[model samples]
Target: MIVSSFFPGRIRLRNEVFKDAEIYAALYAAVGNHPAVKKIERNERTGSVLLEYIPEKLPINKLLALQSDLLALGKLAEFYSAKNKPEILKKIKEIESKL
Candidate 1:
C-alpha cells in the first residue's frame, strides 16, 4: 500500500490489490464501518482509497493495519476451505513460479 496523499484528518492510499473490486470492497466495508471514520471512498479503476476520519480517536496506522489484516484473514480462509484444497496447490505453484 502507498500513501498517495495525506494531511491532518484525511488520507489517500493506493494499492495494486485494490484494483480487484472485491478486495477493495472488502476493505472499504471494514474501514468504513469504523466509529472513527467519517467517510470512505474507493475507485477500483485507479486502485485508490480516500478516508476521512477523527485523527484523535484512532491513529491512521491502526486503521491501515486493520484493513490489511482483514484482507489477509479473508484470503487465508480460502486456503483452508476443503473445497479449495486443489485451488490452494494451483495458487502455490503460481507463487513458486514468481519466485
Candidate 2:
C-alpha cells in the first residue's frame, strides 16, 4: 500500500483556471444570493475565494467545458499580445497531446 502524509490535494489553479473562476464568479455575483449560486467566501488565511457550498450531486462536465473555453481565451489573448505565436501554439499542442 502506498502510504503518504499528503492529504487530498486541491486542483492547482493555473491562469486558465483563474480566468474561468473569475468569469464564473462574476456571472454568479451578478445573480447574487441565488439558491444555485453564491459568492465564494474570502478566506483570510489564504486570501483566496472559497467555494464551500457546492451540492454533492452537481455534475462537473459543464464546468470542465467552461474551463476549456477559458483556456482558449488565454491562448487568444497571447496571440493578440506581443508574445510569440509559437509559444501559444506549443501550449495548445501540449494540451492536445494530453487529449
Candidate 3:
C-alpha cells in the first residue's frame, strides 16, 4: 500500500488489492468501521481508499499501523486468491459489491 495523500483529518491510500472488491470490503469492515473513522471511500477503478478520521481520537501512528496491517492482509489475499475456490471468490466479490 502507498500513502497517496495525508491532511489534517483525511488520508488516501493506493494499493492494487483495493481493486479486489472482496478485500476492499474486508478492509472497510475492519478499519473503516473504527469509531474514530468518520467516513471511508473506496474507488475500485482507481484502487484508492480515502479515509476521514477524528484526529483527536485516533493518532497518526495508530492509523498508519492499521493501514500497514490492511496492506499485509491484502498480500495474503493475493496469495489465497491463487489457491482458493473460484466460486468462493465470486461469492465474496458479489457480497463486497453490495456493501
CA lDDT, every prediction? 0.61, 0.38, 0.66
Model 3: per-residue Cα lDDT over 4-96, one tens digit each: 899868989886667877766766775665678899998888889998989887776665655544455445445455454344345444433
Tens digits of per-residue lDDT for model 2 on 35-75? 43333443334323334334432235534644664466466
Question: Against the hidden true structure, what lDDT does model 2 obtain?
Answer: 0.38
Question: Which has the greatest lDDT?
Answer: 3
TM-score of each: 0.56, 0.32, 0.65
| Candidate 1, residue 3: lDDT | 70
lDDT of 1 at 17: 52
Question: Over 4 Å off in model 1, which ranges?
Answer: 60-99
Instruction: Tell me the TM-score of model 2.
Output: 0.32
Measure candidate 2: CA RMSD. 10.5
Using lDDT as the yardstick, the better of models 1 and 2 is 1
